[model samples]
Target: MQSFRERLQAFNKCVCDGARLMVGQGDYGTYVAHIAKTHPDQAPMTEREFFRNRENARFGVGNSSGFRCC
Candidate 1:
């Protein structure tokens, strides 16, 4: 059984990670793990490309992409 402090720490980490994801912060460790398991023969994208690709997928290309205020 985990102690209260340990559980609290875990919960805090989960919340922080969730917030980061919500704001488009990519998880490189998980990405690497996935690539290692599913595409061992292929090279993974560099960290910069990973984040850029994520942003492109989330928002998209051009001036119309993302939030706009008039």
Candidate 2:
């Protein structure tokens, strides 16, 4: 199984690719946040806050119960 960082990296890459396809390489934080909300494992945050917290952020992707995003 891929680590959280690996999964996040993949997710970011996909977001970037999609953004590039649609709007040309720029910002896709809004889209990323939207996708994150739909997935059980992904953490949801506003586009502005997502970038601000991503570096030290912890998500509860693999563990739903007895876990919190911090």
Candidate 3:
């Protein structure tokens, strides 16, 4: 049986995960934790770098330069 605090934390995490899914922004913490767990000897990127890398990887570019018809 989980304690009240533990249950509440789980519920909160579920809600947050759902909200992130709806908004299309992923949970960075999960990725960070994964890196820490799977590659204990490697250093993880800072939060800003993580998000920038994710954006670039997903979109292939950071800005609208490629979309310009000029």
**Candidate 2 at 30: error in angstroms?**
24
Please identify model 1 stretches exceeding 4 Å from their true place. 1-9, 62-70
In candidate 1, position 34 carries an lDDT of: 97
Q: How high is each candidate's TM-score?
A: 0.65, 0.33, 0.55
Clashing pairs in 1: none
Clashing pairs in 3: none
Q: What digit string (tens of lDDT, one per residue) describes model 3 on residues 1-70?
A: 9999999999999999988656545678987899999999999888888777755655546466553222
Ten-residue stretch with the least lDDT total in model 2:
52-61
TM-score of model number 3: 0.55
Task: Tell me the RMSD of model 1 versus the true structure.
Answer: 3.6
- Please give the distance, in angstroms, between residue 4's alpha carbon in candidate 1 and its true position after superposition: 6.0
Model 1, 1-70: lDDT tens digits are 9999999999998898888698777687789899999999999999999988777666654556554332
Preferred candidate (lDDT higher): 1 or 3: 1
lDDT of 1 at 33: 91
What clash count does candidate 2 reach?
0
